[model samples]
Target: MSDPHLTPNWSTSALLTIDVQRDFLSEAPYGVPGTTEVLPALARLTAAFRTARRPIVRLYRRDGQDADLVRRTLLAGGAAIVAPGSAGSAVAADLLPPGAPPLDPDLLLAGRPQPLGEHEVALFKPRWGAFYRTELDELLRGWGVDTVVVAGCNFPNCPRATLVEASERDYRVVLAEDAVSGLHDIGRAEVTGIGVGLRSVQDITASLTFQEVS
Candidate 1:
């Protein structure tokens, strides 16, 4: 690792926006509290990443007929919000670009990338971490990405899980504090101890100019 005083140089980074779907943002289903409160910040981060020409991957969850359906059913209490092709399975309108490309739930549910924005692709994750059971590692490696800028919903669950997995794989990780939710103080402390940079949206935005889109 480079010296800790170097302001965390990111040679190549991908913005991994995790589980910020309709269900998790509002009352659609399985929504977390405080998620709605961070809408502006999340939008700002998304714009910044797009401007910086960094790769942005939208991590989505889709339900399938898996062996663990019984457990998922129990955890969901028999109500499925993020099921494939469901309205709640899509990203929230606020987070999506105006006239963004449509995503085929089936393709992503099968663990594929669906093109979204200029340099952004949407990938369906079978579980919390984008690295688990997905081609995120190969994709990042192919693009020569080194650092991961993570933002989105429910820090205690998928967000936290994904960050840990990224660190284990030797990627420099930065968690945008204001762009995510569901983080308790203890959890925040734990992430910081692992060398993850916890920064606010405005501070991150200030570091670079956004790219000019045609």
Candidate 2:
């Protein structure tokens, strides 16, 4: 905990990508800015975690009855927001496991995680934080994950909130700085102020490879 460089231990880390769904992509109608630009790097991180046989958790935003006020209002106004079973609700294809199961919006809304691949899952988050009313913390603990590596869309929202929650739960957290969208200087500084380690996509993947080999 003394050194940011020494903080991340990949052996016990879980990779969590938030709000990387199709609808949140930069090209989509309701896209989050910078999401598309980060996809390539984010894909690398996912592939690294998959190859390392670590837990990979993918989070999507589904604007349903339980959605946050802004999203609920948008939904009520006929704005289709990551509608369950809709193509737009699915995670971005580049980051998904090969032959990953489709995003089960209903199950996620009901607070159940959908299996994606071995040691991987896709869950829906009703709010900015992944752990809020979700099984994310339980799942990580069950997987023996003591460290969390987070990346994806809307850093100031979901990713940031999840980082703070992970810290509160006493899990070492790493933010893949270049792999997340909507990031700003203050947001980066704020997370680190709470003991979050900020690393690059290359840095995180390098750690994974090192752990995998020796």
Candidate 3:
């Protein structure tokens, strides 16, 4: 496959915000140093996705014995934000679109679909990729989503891993540079090596006209 950067039409792509919950932000237990810098861009991307009526998948790790090792490690370091029923486990208030419904813990934990405003929905990921042992693939298939625009939270772990997995699943991928954190230039190059599109939130927002995908 060619690099997705050469493709101009990303309107068919869903915007995926990986682990943008309170835990990864500056004020949360699992805060990454650069995480706070991306909020404004993330907000812009979220609004764009919502307006386009494109799919928006928010990935979160729940705290439990069955939780992924990363969540357990973060919790051990005093990042208690991923606890299944805790308020801190909830998505960051800023990331929620205007008039979006509050997260339903019961529905989320039960693996039921919970709507996020009109164009978005919330799903809890059991592992790094949204596809790992989850219904994200099914959901995307149902929506006929072929491309994925990924943003949010640290890069070394979740976002990076998720991108690799998405590529393996044959989805055209774009990584929103400004809406993610913990990514160094070298790491960015690694993603580009795999043919994932590397773009800034500003770049996409400035030039891309988001039309509703059928």
Candidate maximizing TM-score: 2
Candidate 2 per-residue lDDT, tens place, 1-214, comes to 5685438778999999999989999999989989999999999999999999999999888777778886777788899878888999878877877788777766877889899899899877778998988899999989888999999998989999999899989889999999999999999888878899989989888889999999
Q: Rate the local accuracy (lDDT) of all candidates.
A: 0.79, 0.89, 0.78
Q: Residue-wise lDDT of candidate 1 within 1-214, one digit each (tens)? A: 3546324444477788998888777564568898878778999988887778778899987655551454466555676767777778788776766678777987886777888867788998887778999889888888898788888889987899999998898888889999898878998899988878888888766654522221
| Higher-lDDT candidate of 1 and 2 | 2
Selected candidate, larger TM-score, 2 vs 3? 2
- The per-residue C-alpha lDDT of model 2 at residue 92 equals 86
Give the TM-score of each candidate. Answer: 0.89, 0.96, 0.88
The most accurate candidate by lDDT is: 2
Higher-lDDT candidate of 1 and 3: 1
Clashing pairs in 3: none
On residues 1-214, what C-alpha lDDT tens digit does candidate 3 reach at each position?
3544435455667888888877667766557778778888898888777766677888777767667765677567764566776766778767787777767777787776688777688887777777787778888878888888888888988899899998898888889988899889998899988878888887766544534432
Query: Which regions of candidate 3 are displaced past 4 Å?
Result: 1-8, 70-79, 210-214
Q: RMSD of each candidate?
A: 3.2, 1.6, 2.8
lDDT of 2: 0.89
Worst 10 residues of 2 by lDDT: 1-10
